[model samples]
Target chain A: MRKINSRQAGKKVPDYLENNIVRFVYLLRSEGVRIGNSEVIDALQALQYVSLENREKVKTALKATLVKKAADAVIFERCFSFFFTPPETRERLRELRQQKIARHEHQIKEAEQVFTFRGEKMNLSALDKTVYAYMPETEKKRLRDFLEMNESRETLQQWYRPFLETLVKGRLRFWHKQLHKEIQEVIAQRDTGDEELNAIRDAAAGSGYGGRTILTEDMQHITRKELPQAAALIRRMARLLATRISRRYRYSKKRRLPDLRATLRASVQFGGVPFKLKYKSCRIKKPRLLLLCDVSGSMIRYSSFVLQFIYSLNAVVQRIESFVFAENLERVTPYFQQGQDFERTMTAVVRESGQWGGGTSLHSALKALMMRYGDELTGNTTVIIVSDTRTIHHREAALELEKLREKVKEIIWLNTLPRQEWSSYTTVAAFQRSAAMFPCNTLADLEQVLSRKFLSA
Target chain B: MFVSLEKLQKGFTSAGYICDEEVILTVYLALRLEKPLLIEGPPGVGKTEMGKALARIFHTELIRLQCYEGLDENKALYEWNYQKQLLQIQAGRVEGRYGRVDGDLFSREYLLERPLLKAIQADRKVVLLVDEVDKSDSEFEAFLFEVLSDFQVSIPELGTIRARHIPIVVLTSNSERELSDGLKRRCVFLYLDFPGIEREIEIIKARVPQAGERLTAEIARAVHHIRQNQEIRKKPSIAETLDWARTLVSLNMDRLQGSTIERTLNILLKSRGDQRVFREQIGADALEKKIRSSLV
Candidate 1:
């Protein structure tokens, strides 16, 4: 790295500090923190105000200029320690990267080797070649012996090609399992003296799913220890949602029709000249949210997160109604409205309601909701149903959902199942007919769904 | 002007603001770079207090704009004194100077300067604190971009008005909303979390000197413990901590006993829900025991 030195506060600053700061900003951007050129420049300019002798001052100065959000601060801390602490660590990390690249290149070369059968080169698929290259020496010898024995069989000649392909595919699956296990073991053994550097490298390499940021991790796979971080991220997303909704309402409130009567009434003080115009100031109705969360065995994990999100939005939305259902629907809006802590409230709802960890009956749940809260459904209401779409009596449930859809402005189905698995579930197809379905198995998906559905409206 | 970072830290300390190195460094850079400092954190983390402290340290005026829903440019930037203009027009008709009043209607004489305009048009450097800026509409936030970037505002009648002496700008938010990327990019960002245990004790001692040293330490530890509880929705703020300390001093309590804590817990935990959680989950006796154990 080229070094540039500058004078600030009558002190000579180190040349490498600027170069390191620029690299650190890029590191932050790669870790999903947004930074622009101006911020980079600001970070550079901030260096002039602090003495480089003090490490904490330098870190703080860079942080003030480069980081904008609180959630990104944790990533910044990790990256800062990894990049700036113990100058030799950076060199060590560079060496590790080089070694990793060399290893990958060697593996690719080995995978390019062709298989031979009876002095003739056999054309193999890419999967077979990869599996052959990475497989253990013993497994390779076993495969060779098996193939050699089968090569001279005249009775099985007609069915040879299909059989060979199936055998290679089975080996490919086993190879994948082996590779995954090795990677997990490598991650588990933190041999690196610098744990922060190892963690950053692991996350960058995408080896350990647990090493990934909480925002991008799947909700169901989030461990108990990571729940607090996940909950904080959810709360931040909810806060952003509330702000967008309030801003939209405030903007629309300003564009109302002019109130000529009020204008005249005000002009009476000014000789009836109608000097100023008055707006009608009609009350803008906040969008009503009705959340129906399925607490069945399959969807219990996602429902708790969704309920926590709704609980965070309790103060912002005036007419939010929450319902959790398994075999039957139970209204839990009162629990949220009580202003108690979410943990206690969630515990009470789970214990008192008869819908905890049971089979899903969407038809009965929707029927019970309509019969009890039919008057609350209106054009302003948005019905959000969080579920896996796996329920008994799918046909009746679809019909009831369509009926509920007709009474509300829109029905948004947050399917807990991944998008690739949606096709395998017939219930997903049926539910898709009456509601706009979005796969929301992760916090990122939930944020995107909420922003697209609610903010756009 | 502060020639060194140590001087700035001392200035802030003298101003009665207990800030860490991060705060001092960020504020120093903001001052040197002439960039707006956007401070965001949870409620009552001294985001607004930092701005006030800056103004006090500099011996300048602190012009505040308390942002809320539907805040507009006219209210924040500047507004025309319409009634004065109308009176002028009526007087001009009587005096046969209608054309003169028409020219004077949009002049500086009738222009009412709000916080933004006042900060720009001040004869000396001032501190501008836009408090709870996240509460304002996005349009208002967008409107701020122009004034903040160039330190100037354009009025149709008076044309562009630039700053006489560029005032130091500090914007505070409670993280109620995410600010625009454009706005965030234009300023330096700082996040103020709750003070740590030692810092809280120092703050209590500074703000409420009547309280005994033992009492202050116990109060700080108890408050820290409560803040660590995830169940409490609204954590006790520094101001609340000081208030609790003062209450302890006035009540002549030297140490935090279980009964005294039970009686005075409401001072720190404002909401009934927070109070109930503190009682049921982390009871007064448990907290007292923890505090006493820490002391030993």
Candidate 2:
């Protein structure tokens, strides 16, 4: 057998080391890795089994005891390395912090110089920044704190959009609009020092200084890099949809009569007449979702977000079969099952399907899709088509869609086009006649549309 | 009981099990604190083997409970012997002695003990391995709280039967579904990934002793490389590495080469798809070259 390969091999651990381990466990917990008191006790006892000098052994031991899930192992490993940084690295980190402080002080001095410049023309007091500067720093800080408060409040309103208007105990929309108007007027009127301030604002926006940034009305404005957040929001919305739909369906229908076998078994003492009736609770057969996503050039921007949404929904409800189409269709149901990262899964999907780069041919795509996977759809299936419906020069595949609608419970089309522009797109109007069309131009649209159509019904 | 974790590690090593610090530490803590150790890993990573090894170290009987879908408390815990109860009831009625014995029939004499109950009621401490617990439903997972947390089982008829000896519980899961937070909160969670190359070599030499050192190293290295290839479905595990080494020794190969690997590829790769993927992607020559480079 190999002997313990560390300088402190067979050495007893001191009491302070256990305290350090406990603190490390709490650090892991604060980083959103779930760890319990049992794990802390285990870690303290487990340190006896391994040499502290042996970094790899200590890491593996802590990981085994602390991390429960594979996804959490990533977080654990990252925090582990940071927590156990080497002595030299600690010194280097101190030096880096000093340098960062110096740089921050220099940048602040430059910012103060620019702001203090009294521009002779174009009165700058109308601007929000000049007005904020006149107030105490505490007042400005409160404004920032209030903005932080509104961010979470805005997220809550995103979930309950319809009810937010009536519940007006704490509404800050008027104040937000006033500040935004002042900022806009400042930008509109050019002053002597305004260029430097505008440059500073551009830099802040580029680096994402959250406190100073103005909130846009469109809550669904997500960049390509924000796919992960968008995906999480979609998952939350999917769960909300599932619960709402199930609860509504459960209450709307009548329960079946008391189960005879159960009643007889329970009523054996009472000569078969049931004393406490066991009603046959209706088992809600979850509707199977079959998604047909358009992946042409026009719909490529919205397709990924839609696919992530569908994938998260599939996670909650397992009865979803997804297919992607451009000129032809390919079943992407198996890709989501792999549980790989969204980017990697999408890359694989793109590589496998020949029609990923082709034009949108709705007639041919739907015909081929029905020819292949039409048998998979039952009366309990909900066929969801996620596309802009901008088919180029092809006739509205109404016959195939009508046939599909006949086979499934309902055919719902998620149009990526804006509501005003939907009239300009002739193909979408034609398809809307065959199926129910809902505008899904953004992430918020998806939540509203899903709630209005499925849950409300 | 073992004096320390080092002693436990030594005992396992002497028993022909190559355990890393993680396994040794977790086993030690579980024994010391009397908490159930929840071990999760990909299949065939010696999760079940670790439980058995710990049992040997403790010198206790290993009671295994394999979990599957729809597994309930009836199968896991004690169940009543309905036939005996019914017969006794019939005899009581014949003798006209059944005035109001409402709860007398539901006694310990009519209880049929399963693995879980047997472990709890064992005379001495035993190793209770709840293997592949993720296969069981969430309701059954919640049902385990009474036994897992307090070392007692509640029967509506008998109130609660506490454990005679708190068995060293070892729960393993392949993470088929998310386990209940209540269950996780009670146990010390441990995740065992695949062993490193050197550790795997030690395991191979211990299990397949006839295989020479050179052949053992080569086989371990090949298995390590195969596992890194994400394209191959069903990566070759440590057990498969041992089997491949044994296969090579049985064929009387003094050293490993491209041809030897090609002939015994079936032992390493389980599926035809995996075999084809290995042949087309990472061929025998590539594996041999890696082994040679590592040896140098």
Candidate 3:
């Protein structure tokens, strides 16, 4: 155990320790852990009481003072271990970073030598060349064609040489889109050669954190080991959502008219002066939910997560009707009502439905649902459709959804496809026109959409 | 208050609360810094017990405020005894002494102190346990901000009631809902998970000394095995484990036999669904075999 001198009463914190704590706090904030000034001051003050001889005591003190949520605890542990390394280890890590930077510079130099335009040397900066090298073949070909088409001998002579470079760089920037800055950052970090430092930076930045947290990880990519943790998170989120919905009814109770009979009954103790007035107990109308999950091959992973989420809400939502669709719609509410293990329920649902992993037919499915369960889709019902919006006869499906929207309170489409790729699928745009569509490819996305949309509604 | 972490641990042990160094460290720091300790975990993880243990260690009163839906300031903090006030008003009018009625109505005599106010006005330090705070409404949670941070509560009639002695406050949550960032900021957070098998065996031996060593070890192992079943909705809590051990001891059982577990499983698993799953999925015979294997 490494020991440091404890701060005495009415004494200031050592400058080095104070700086480390501030840096650690900054790292935590960057990693999405919210820490306030009061917490920092408490941590410093707490350090005075605990013996510095015990490392665990110091760590526990800081963690208790700083970290509030259980979810942020993982990030705190990682950042703590990284921040509080021994001096010799930190020095070695610093040297390793310098060595990596040297290797990155060498690679950049080599790339610059081979980066030529039209058999003549192109005088582009190392950053520009690195970005150009990272582009795909198709984008590279497009860039070459654009240069060939735009750069005429006369124009090149009339304009400055730097103008052509600027023109090429602008096209490269446009091709990279939102990722242009991130790519530039990666290249910049390469020059620093600080792998551990970069890891900490990336972890703190919440982008490409080491083995991305299960919440932010793609639903389809969650491994067998992480499945239990993912399920727990989903259950926790469902309970939270249920609580929010329940709170609405609690608030609505206050708005109810006074109960005259109960007020009079209670006034017997006070000689009928009516000191304690009670509100009329309102019957809570639990929100009716209709879940339509697409269990086609393309959307099975996302559908499983959605089904699990809905199943977890069974205790809270009394009037939920679940349905699964592939080539046709099949009501699977019975499977959920059985209240068995979710995995077994899912297995039974897949076995009995006969539509699992088949092609999607949203138009036919919606029509079938309307024909069979038309009475169930009242104005109080909110229909949530989980799909990638990849279906046969997209326009007809969109029309059917619009019709369903008229009969229901709302239609929410949770599209499994990433939002960036939505433009590529005409079906997504078609369904989006009729319903409020949100990306549901990850737990974070699902959480954001559900909390924002459902809570507001 | 304890001067060192070791003494705090020993105090907790003597108080019959089995905990690790981390828990002791957190409690020590919270006591030293005079901050409210926010303990969150799954149900039956000894969160509320921590408060009770603290009270025992300090020889202070354990003032508990059980939070729930629609809980408000009138229930948690001070409230004017309206019936008494009305009677005073009526009597004053009858006696032609109305001038003194208004002043006396809102006085300390008419102020009914709830748990929050009671803790604040206590002559000596006490352990104020705000249990299941997540079950309370957001407005009530926000109202707790003033009491927890500055140890003071403001009444419209009475200006402000600062704590006579800063009570050691322990707030426990099952995480049914996410607490506000503002409430979390003013607290020292500690998460208490279920103890491991060895520690749990220690707990069983400590709490239920009537049970033999083999029986305690077998019960701990059996509970641990049952907890590993993800399909079991409600895992056996430590309290439930102790109850099961006590039940077995009362029944004059030395070991967890398959038949005994089937008969006494109700004590461990509360929900019918969980019991059914435990029987159908994690069979008693299988758990018995696993427990017996440890002996070999």
TM-score of each: 0.82, 0.63, 0.82
- Model 2: lDDT equals 0.68
Among all candidates shown, the one with the greatest DockQ? 1
- In terms of lDDT, the best-performing candidate is 3
- lDDT of model 3, residue A426: 88
lDDT of each: 0.79, 0.68, 0.79
Predicted model 1 interface RMSD:
3.7
TM-score for candidate 3, residues paired by index: 0.82
List the candidate numbers ranked by lDDT, top first.
3, 1, 2
Question: Candidate 1: global Cα-lDDT?
Answer: 0.79
Which ten contiguous residues of candidate 3 chain B have the minimum total lDDT? B1-10
Off by over 4 Å in 3: A1-15, A98-199, A202-216, A223-229, A250-284, A340-344, A361-381, A392-412, A418-438, A444-457, B1-3
The candidate, 2 or 3, that scores higher on TM-score is 3
Give DockQ: model 2: 0.31
lDDT (10s digit) by residue, model 1, range B1-296: 54477888889878889968778888888999999999999887899999999999899999999999888987899977777766777787788886666666779998999999999999999999999998987779989977899999999989999999988999999977668899999999999999999998888888888888899999999999999886677899998988889888889999999998999988999988779889988999999999999999
Candidate 1, CAPRI quality class derived from DockQ:
medium
Q: Please provide, for model 1 over A1-457, each residue's C-alpha lDDT reduced to its tens digit, 9 standing for 90 to 100.
A: 2233332234544557565676567667666789999999998888877677777877888899999988788777777666664535544555665576477557656544435444444556654565566678788778767776777776665446666756756776667556643434343444343333443454444434334666666688788787766776677676676676655552345647887656754664454478888887666677777888888988877765876776776755767888889999888888888766778787887778888889999999999999999977898777888889999999999999999999998898988886756866899999999899998888878776765635634
lDDT of 1 at A224: 79
Stronger candidate by DockQ (2 vs 3): 3
A248-351, model 3: which lDDT tens digit per residue? 65235454789775675466455447899888877667667788889888887666586677678665566788888989999888888876777788778767
